[model samples]
Target: MRKTIWKSMILSTLAVGSFAFPVPASAAVQVNPVPGLRQDFIKGADVSMLPEMEKNGAVFYDVDGTKMDELQIMKNHGVNWIRVRIWNDPKYGVLGGGGYTDEQRALELAKRAKAIGLKVLVDLHYSDGWADPGQQYTPHAWKNDSPQKLEQDVYDFTRKIVQDFRQQGTLPDMMQIGNEVKNGMLWPVGKLPAKDGGKAFFRLMASGLKAVRDLDPDHKIKLMIHLPDGGDNDVYRKFFDMLVKDNGVNDFDVIGFSYYPFWHGSLQDLQKNLDDVSARYGKEVVVAETAYGFTTDNYDQEKNHYGPAEARRSGFTATVQGQASGLRGVMSDLAAVPDGRGLGLFYWEPDWYAVPGAGWKAGSGNNWENLSMFDQNGKALDSWDVFRDVSDETAPVVPVTVTEMDEPEAEGSTGIPVKLPQSVLVTFSDEHQEMLPIVWKDSAPVYDKDGDYSVSGSVEKIDAPISCDVTIKPKANLLQNGDFESLSLDGWTVTGDKWTAQPTSGKGDAKGEGSLHYWGGTPYQFTMSQEVMGLTPGKYTVQVSAQGKEDSSKFCLFLIGDNGEKKTAEISTTGWNQWRTVKIADVEIKNGKAVVGVDMKGAPDKWGSVDNFKLYRQEDSKAAK
Candidate 1:
């Protein structure tokens, strides 16, 4: 319980830190030059070597121009290693797929890294498409093989790949036999160590491990057993112990875990799990895949895969500040480990920001960019600054992995649930953009797509620098999935709210004004720097506004408290469309900043645009009482 209080305090501090400080507009963060260090763990990033449009087609994406220059950037961020995956006979969805094979893109990137003193870790997937525990289709060449034949093939393929890389001076410092092999590779013969006491999987893994050892038997190369979901130590224990029980597979090097907050548990849980695993097995541990989000709402919903709540519970606030804080938490936990067993980490696809055609969606771009290390325009994020030295003595300038726990919790309960608040009508409206003016609610509202309110399924960005709480309600629609969640530009937050540049087509979307802010409900002004502006102490009615209206533009009004719950309101807007105004004649303001923004909930198409808003003192003054 005491530990819980501290974690909560850290979370709260992170939430209010933004509103408390005066942030610079369009500010570029200063990255401290990471001092040269002899790090035991490999600090790397999984930058996909996108199969070139052609052999050398400009590397056309995020090259030096966009900070996509891997070699230099890795060095800058204290990333000393690069992990590249290899696929067999894959067209990668191009001209019958005349793209990079294992010897192509991976080799090229590996060569580049080696040439620049960067270490490489090679991942062998033996399959054409993505191969995890769920889907591990044997490569075409090995599809027709018998169990023994497949084992031999794995040994040969792995040996040949390692030898080839070694000959090219790009030999891997560490090699991952398979990618997320919850179930082992090669299928019926090599699936995960079965719950039914099977030896097929262990034998297959041994085949790969031995092949790696044959080429260079001096333990010069570290071997890592990769698994998805870091929070589940039970999975690791089950998989590893089964492997250990087998006579064929035992001499592995490190335990690699994937730590994705939305999918994995909190870092507290992860650390405890890691501490236990490494101590028991006597192996090093590295979080091979980790990333935190910088934005709560997606700007271009078409591309990217990060739907809301990507990084909320694990103490990551889902804001630029939160991402920074989250990294700090992970690193600090790593530092506290004994024997420095916590090697380091790799930010999974950290460079996956918004490129011209780079997004998560199939038809659109990938949605993972919102959680990328850099912003869409290739700007480095503030999150990088989170990596710091132990005590400002051992090269404080350089990016250090696993410094001491900054605001650590007690032993257990890192994953303990906080009693987050439920949905409350913070603010409501009938027209344009309607949003619940929430401010740092202990927990974001749970408004699902039940087809009632025009809401947004996106999670609340409840961290600092943007501590305002908000939820864009979705509208109900019979024809489609009711994308009625219109965004409001009121109450300290602004989003397209499912409102795009395109024209409205159905019920959910409509032109704005009525939903978000009340046009003349006094005067609710805004300036991002101030959280609670010192208002002239007097009775005042809060006024609001909305944008993107064709004719009689209307507005809504509401006062909101911290955490995004509705506070107070007076009247509503009925008529006055053509750039006109309306009022909700009542209310008062004591002091501090009054958060304001318009909402375009249920608004569709070119729906929910907003601007020109303020807060005014009520005329009732002394007489209203």
Candidate 2:
């Protein structure tokens, strides 16, 4: 599930909207034949909100306004699998405000999915609400249990849940023991870096695994261990190494990941991580949750979570064509996994249209409306054709070429520009009336002097080799240890009550080993600053990644003058689990000296951290004598 700080907050009243319910279709109605992809590959979606939507009188309509069964529509469009999340004893009833994912609802949905000949994957959140990397609150009933007791509880709860599903003839085809267990599940007890070197965490997870194995004696269900951010290779390496190699608790059959292109890295990063993990662990990899926007337009009153700007950053246009293209690229990457370990992908909540009472929370209608395969009006989009039309055999092939451009003088050069190929050609095995468009980037390479260097790039929307080799020189970063890659605060000074150099708990700077954490206990303030001094004065650009635990906490990145005057840019701590970059442009560095750092003022219950500090002198600035 997507992480949000306000996930548990509830609205006092539900929004009012009109709904038209159509006559229920018979469960035995025959559907179209299953659309085959690569051999045994899974094309799936998570329709956890379907039950709630139906209960609220929401209805699905085809493009012609004909009412249709949601599951049958998905099966006709090539989706063979369905995922449902289960929450343990939610505060709200099964269809209540905050917790709609209770066991009974999940089982009901699972049975309905199975009735449509679709496989089911059960996601065990083990919490009343969302359980992600940011917050993994233990279920209220198990909050006070001892570690040993908690382990037993996990086993007992999992066994009972599986047994219940079996008795109902709706056992999940695949099961996720935990949802996004990147930082460990169930909070402090089962969380990472435990007092005994994560032994307790592994033991807790082991109990859950044992329950799944014992319950499914015939090995009918495949088990999965899920983590967030499928693009982070280091995280996968660190996490699985501890769980499998070091601890010897490798019982899961599949490795599941959540890959949201905007939050995670680029497609290249996703491919690399998937390849590495599949080869190293020899486990089938599945993108358990992924989605792309087809439009930035807000059709409903509720705010659309992804806008045009974010969709563009993801290298795909916020249009139907772009969504289709994005899925094609993703499928291509997954198909390329070594030894065919790539099982497939599941579009997260693609049916979450902007219907009445179908929103993630009360009063707010479908924040992910733009990402749904169906438009806000409940009409299927062109993106749905991606599943029916594009297959491994008929996939579009895109070929790219990169050629070097003549290098100019290196004097005062900040970035080197490379010429792009005149045109990238796309071809398909069968003839097509139109050509598929492509999205690509030609990044400016850093050139310090006139020498040989290498630069990388990527192309999206088709299956193709996206990398090319270019020659250039490299430029030097003025601030030493700017990214904290050295694992020490060698060139930084702390002027406050509390600061520590440590590996960040959540997603840190895109590339780094450590970050400066400021624990300014209640009502305190601290600053971690680094000064770069020399002769040659000019304009510089300062950029840093900083975040805080709470909204009240303040985190600011500043450029300090020699006389102590500071030019600061405030950083928003809204998405504490995600990193946001703060850039101070055109900062004048008179006397060739300035202090660049982050200042954090701690709130009563919050702290802040900063990392990936970078200072670059503008090449266009006048040179100092």
Candidate 3:
């Protein structure tokens, strides 16, 4: 669930905050340097879309408005390494277009990095498109290959790639065998948690490792094993333990973690996991990928991946300064790694600013412009100063105290528990500050009656206690048992096979204590519905948390009014346990009675789970229309 390259790139096409000219250079934030920063620390960027972007009229400029090559601009701003993704055959993509990360494109980027004196890290996805914890469809050409044949193909294909790089005089400085192989790669044959899947995955990984080693007998290029969920120590421990002790396939130079603060966890969680895994496996740890949004504007029909909710989780605002602080926090965490086992980090796709005619595929919008290091006009943002200032090693800003820190506050409907901020921004005596995690006395506070409540909390670095003020208004949800905490569908009308209730303690996609689960040895279609009576007639919206394994299955959240009015919102799932919220909004409730539920038509051997069905008045709902 780390990411989908295609989906992330297909953002929004509409221009936002456009200007007749570039922003002034003075608009960038200038910061003092970090103390004792390492000279060889990896300040990297994954600008794989540079070729496509430039080809489609994208122009890069410095803070001073001087036009320059994107790679050159990155190098000037302290980026010393470039990461490029290589797809086997993008022409076979499901979208029926040439994938942008083919060998030629990757090699071109590598050459550009080399020309600018920057090191290169080659990321091999193995598949023709995106490969992550969720989906890992094998390359179409190798679809019919057996395990033995697949192993041979991996070796041959990898060897040829390395050879091509060597011939071009742009051999990558480091190579990742596979991209984010947390749940393993190459689909069912190598999918993890299965009976024999681990063995098959190890074999395939070993084959790729052999190719890199053979091509680099001198061992000039470092090798790495990359995975998602950087803050989850258990995931790292189990995966590495199995690879090292059980299968004996631990021949790698680095352990790479893709940690996006919002998706992974707090900065404290990241530091703890990095410290543990680096010590446990005795390998160098590098944050392979990370990024934060500088703004929340969606600009078009495409919704941004990072917003207020994600920002709150990280204890940072969606602002230019917030973006800088987030990256600085990451750098500080890595710097604190014991024995200097922590290497450095790479910002994913910093150059992928929104522009017409350039996206993940033809006619697709860019959903990640808010997270780009460049603005809509390709002007370098003030946050880029973090890299420049850190690399310069000018001076350090000391934090003396947090007397001027801001208190936390939020509001929510009575039925649902108000989500307190996980972290808080602490301003110090010198006015230099950072966002730190908060340890609350009462972590979960749910109020049945409408009123205001305060939860006391303490910051790890601050001795003084703080309180978060929450305003709980009247309940907005019109239905009951929506969170599935009852461990059964007591209020839901069930159809098809009997479903299982999964507890939150497990790895199921339940956001609360329990969720509705469905799957069997045979194919099936089912519905878990609820009819709510006596609703105030008006525009309404329903939101449900759900995930599934079948990409072809038609899973939808639907609503029907008493007068036969109907509406449906399709749920698009990336993987079995990677949950996402799906909602049908702006339903005019002409009658007092309305029925809503999940209707799933799953294929044989496929599975899915759902939880947290909430019905809110249209004005109170946050779901995109």
Candidate 4:
């Protein structure tokens, strides 16, 4: 079932979503044999998003009973609980940031959650900023401390935070000691794996968990030890085995899983992992954090994006319909896990939609709006309310007990179509193709003409999520020998402040394709002084693109200031890949070199290939000056 997809480099064609859009076959006639099914049920979304609702004037529980709010709408749709993440003193990054869950906001939202009769689960990430597998920098105040001090801080913070919530009458129904702590957290002193310098990882975890117990004492709290997205059995196995041995394993209650279908493996893998976890650890499982973007385009260019599916999924389709349907399927599968052991799952922050000031990364804002449950304007999306069992606003709830079926089969009475799922198998014939010609699609990632090989998407470049394939295969077709295929923009330089464009690995950036035309040193380098010309008195911006194996290097888009001073806009190219676009901005003037490109690192090397250069002048006069 090969479908026609538009493939291109991008200027601006982003929508929030999960996978490549499976070319819709006009008829429902089968193209291939569908795989086994997951007859799972759903519990609903995390009600923690209600605070955003209140802040937005969208009522969760109307004191005066004014009108139906998203919370009521959610409950009516079958959502039973709201999960809130509690961070310690996250005034700057977590608490004050828009859209992200902060402590104060969490309390506000928790009150709304309780008011709505929604069970609340308090997730505590010891750090004030985002905590995940990749990087878990310690909290600022705790940074300059000994391992013992850090340990006490972790315990005290968890204890006091939980105690405060309890005192406020909004104690979380359950509490997660730390957020996705696979690699361990609160660095420098309490880091996990005890690697680098933080030699007290396990002890650090103990300190925190102990604190939770100290505060509660009753042991009623359902403690959770969350790891990264589920589906990676090897990673989890290693992590769990280490925890059991080093941390003694009894510190937590529930096994927290964060499953994102696109990044993680298939539902089959997920089920297998869950069963394995429950069987191996003898603990209950809860999908602590889970979500799927309604679209792939960045709704707000100023903030955060989950990295659109197009930029990540070139092997299978990452579409809104697919993600939603996948969510339904995931829920259903979890329901069927042994012993109702699959308790429930929470849709991570379904209320995080588009808002004027909501963003994640600094400088760029609102780039992830399309990926949120809401649009850029903060309005809810139809997709946001989607639930397999109780999506319909007018749908009647089938009682948990039925006279005929014995158990609760009330959901069967409803006509909610079972979201048919297509299992993506890594088969021989359909081996993940690296050929861009076969892989590219008609999307933001595929920024060019539909089904055509696009050289560059646009000149006035804005950051867009990039999606492509890997260059693992050793073989290539003619032209020149190379091992990788990379995203290259046209007018952009090979190296600049924003990125370090690298050479194809003696081959194209992507596999199956020959050595790319402008990939390596053979691909001419667009140097400074020769690239930029016009300038004005206002600020101007030019986004730089970089890709490939060679990551570290210096590059910049330079401009001569009115004082004849040489100023350059440098974007951090610390972590460059073929799948993202970085922006560059600096003041410009009517002079020489308004936008110049230069490789600051004098050492000769193939950094990366940059193309689709975009120039945005603050004032229109700058464009003409």
Candidate 5:
């Protein structure tokens, strides 16, 4: 899911205050030539928030530190097309900021893009807010319209928008009928699984198609039917069959798909689906949206959508080179499509890097900064070279030698076999590294005694064996960062008003310099939670060393069992720095995970500090057998 904030271009010069901008560290990726690649292959990016970012004091810099417009940098790095999304009356709501992507903003962006000799693709969301597979809410103004009225509204609205763009000489090169309509658009009436066997959905889609075709009978602008999950073959085959074979609505020229490997299936699945669908339907295919995180670090208060978990799933490391590798992988897959059916791909929101005032909505922070093509400093990432390099696609790079290997790490109780990472990072001769699959006779380490151990394995490409060193010394503390030594809430999710990390003086068995601290001048409630995943079925104990103001403030250490059972231990404090141990024992771990947290509630001047939050397994547990 994409989270973005936009502002009016007129207000781009407004001051939004200062923010920390880190300098670019990695060198630009080296471009390689891919033989037989189409000369007109699309290298696109959706930088709809360019103006909004600029309004919030964002400045774009080229690789060489030359401050410039983001679009110019994109063009310089081989970006040939840009995608801009337009929402119907999104002045207020989730995108509310008086600067949402209305028709005016989209047109302005389109005109600027065209002026730069870059093609523009218009994405019509058909909703005031986000319209994706999970959401397709009817616009507020069209909420009360009948099915017949709604269809006509869609037709008229679409025609008028196209007419405006055409009159301004900024006609889109391509247009998406509706954003990610796999589940249908303009919900309820046109929602999927209709009683009329998808007739409503098809009719709604056909109306939009007819509107665009009516304006441009010569088909100067190609229209596309967009869908999510490009890797799912069954979804594509079934969807297109219903739309074309059964419903006879095939006026669209391109089949657009959104493929995010972390959310969708693997790269192979994407290639298979794209190859099959293009041949089966005989239409051009384009990856409408795709992005990968260059880092797992959170640049703002909002939690990053693509974290370490997503990185591991994407089979790539969270690094600049990994980002380039991912883009190359997608580009290579698209290029391999039989019969040149693959049109190209558009990187989603590549310019929406972190800016203090620019967030998904008001008061929120950026959750997608890690996935942006630019770094926190607004400097272009080396991955931008993928657009330039893919043109010269030569033979694939191979791992000649293992330059580096990331050691695997895991924590579990003694005598239990803990599952280690299946893939390990291996930097190869190509200068880029990937989390390639590894094999070993003893993949899962069974430690009879608690300590640290090294496990060796063979990586897929490297001739030499790679080894991993892990500490069995959790002392059975399943809760990571229990001592808060990281000085950050690395493993915990803090919700409610501003719980912070404060330094501790080794108070009452707290080993780290940091402790989870919370202070509120007014009444408030907060939860600092850590979800420990992949636990063996057994009984466990949750414990924490805590201190607080000796008052009526309610602070409790709690645990939600895997099956949703809850247990809590009320924490009592005598005075500041007078720490006491709070424990909740006999918590059953029926599922493979447990949620442990500290929930606080109180009035003005209430304060608390917690450290050494740990979960311990019972000796006579069922999993121990």
Candidate 6:
């Protein structure tokens, strides 16, 4: 979701609550009251490819064009923590394929991060390759082991890794027992809904947790259980509920989630989910993996994974400005968590530039080059500004009370003025001198054709910025079966050979019975169009949730006018497995009938799908102006 950072001046009356104090035994005694402060928000990055990029002749430079050590550069950008991932045994073993994050390689990286006074977060995949919601393969050596033996192996391996770090005096400050294990880990033995009575999954996780606790006798290392899809509260609630209540496993310090905006949901949804999970579990939460593309243009001949298409789907342009804005939105959301239970965030692989010989697998050069904080040329991008101005120490004290005294009034007639809240009285203690008053800057006016209209005010404080959300209920959707939950292409007219109804994959719509999948055919052409009639539209927005299979494919949403004119908005394939919203705004539907649909072309090897095609007729309002 696109967010605006508003700056406004505030004039407010201060109301202070009176308190009675009891005298201490010694009037001259100096005492420090308990600090009513949140933990220092962590700003971190996963530069697992730092060593490989540096070794492959990639030189990093600061914004001023002066060359510096990469670690120092990150440190200079307000980065206080670094994360490194470790695979059990890569295909070519440790130090092969540009040091593919084996145990030793991870330790080296951790030591380097520590050398610069950066805390380390260790991510253990427990597999040879990637381990996520879709796939979590067991190590080759333990693939054939029995359930009991695999649990033992998990304990042994975790303990050994922790021991190695402890002996080197570089134990990680935080350790993720598993990386994005949404479906559980260790494949068949410990997979979710475990065939063997669901005990194996918890046993494996318990083993890992025990190993961390046992190896670090001092209990300095914080343990985190990570899962992907940070916006899905159901996934987190169900998984953790099962793990803790049903499976009897509940010893973890932090709840980590991977939240790539394109793949996940909007920033608002993420904020809601984080708030719910934090309040429900009463545990610290962190966005373990997040990144935005700086540019859609490829810097190297090697196929870039996150290109222009991916950037569009990410709801941000593939520009340095977009990267900074996206990161700012994410960080702001993380910091807005109620009671400050939101710990912080980590940008995944911010240093993985498109350097030769530094690829995920053999010949698959850096797919995440565009998402790095540094440019393809190894020059730091403007995104580092997110880390430059660290202000955790300066956050204003929480307000005691901020109440909306009066609701805004808007007349139904045209040219009628709608009165909105001008200011709010803020109550705070005398110590909170730096706390600024809340001011109304702008508001989103919601208007429905059915005569339901409301306005949401946007407020902001300069010093300690926080989101002030005003709920506005939206109008009903104009299009039928927008979610495609009927399991049939009842309203859509499918053209070309590849459009078919299939089960929805990835995230986006709760009613996931079916979706329209369009595979690029031999001639590379496909379209799914739906006609919506009976609409008096001045302006409308066409939105669809979609995902693609490869970066080369183009998925577009178009509004076809009655006279053959078309307004189109398209997103290139990005996070193909993760669903994202594609929206075309301000579409002037002159005629009552307009054809709304998606078109797929180019890159026959790739396929794309869409669901939840919604059309909303925007009401003419003064607030919208």
Candidate achieving the largest lDDT: 5
Write candidate 2's Cα lDDT for 133-181 as tens digits.
7667788899999999999989999999899999999989999989998
Question: Of the pair 2 and 5, which is ahead by TM-score?
Answer: 5
Q: How many Å off is the CA of 174 in candidate 5?
A: 0.4
lDDT of 1 by residue, 130-239 (tens): 66655666877888899888889889988988888888877788888888887676665676545646576666677889999998889888888888768878888887
Candidate with more favorable, higher TM-score: 2 or 4: 2
Off by over 4 Å in 5: 1-27, 95-99, 393-401, 408-457, 466-625
Q: TM-score: which candidate is best?
A: 5
TM-scores, all models, native as reference? 0.57, 0.66, 0.69, 0.58, 0.70, 0.62
Worst 10 residues of 5 by lDDT: 14-23
Ranking by lDDT: 5, 3, 2, 6, 1, 4
Give the alpha carbon lDDT tens digit for every residue of 70-159 in model 4: 667567645777777765555655555534566777788778778978778888777766777645778777878887788788777777
User: What does candidate 3's lDDT look like per residue over 314-421, in tens digits?
Assistant: 545577766776787777788778888778899999888887766656667676788888888999887887777665544434322233455766555644555566
State in Å the error of residue 265, model 1.
0.5
Cα lDDT tens digits for candidate 6, 1-625: 1123222332333422111011134321111111222356778998877776777798999877989888888888778899998888887233355347788888898888888899999998888877776568898889889989998999999999999998888989999999898778888787886566567888899999999998776779989999888888888998888888787788888999898865576677788888998888878899999988877666666655454334434545566655755665566677777888878899998888888888766565676788888877888875685564335334222222222222223222222122232433222211111212344444323333324444444335423233333322233355645665533344467666432223232233222745665543233666778876655546777888876675665668898766678999976656555778878877776666678988776564566567778776667432344
lDDT over C-alpha atoms for residue 261 of model 1: 61
Q: Candidate 2: give the clashing pairs.
A: 448-474, 453-472
Tens-place lDDT per residue, model 5, 549-580, is 78887888899987787788898878677888
Q: Report the Cα RMSD per candidate.
A: 16.6, 13.4, 12.1, 17.3, 12.0, 13.2
The lDDT of each candidate is: 0.50, 0.67, 0.74, 0.49, 0.76, 0.67
Tell me which residue pairs clash in candidate 5: 32-392, 33-392, 33-393, 33-394, 34-392, 34-393
RMSD of 6: 13.2
lDDT over C-alpha atoms for residue 509 of model 2: 28
For residue 244, model 1's alpha carbon misses the true position, in angstroms, by 0.8
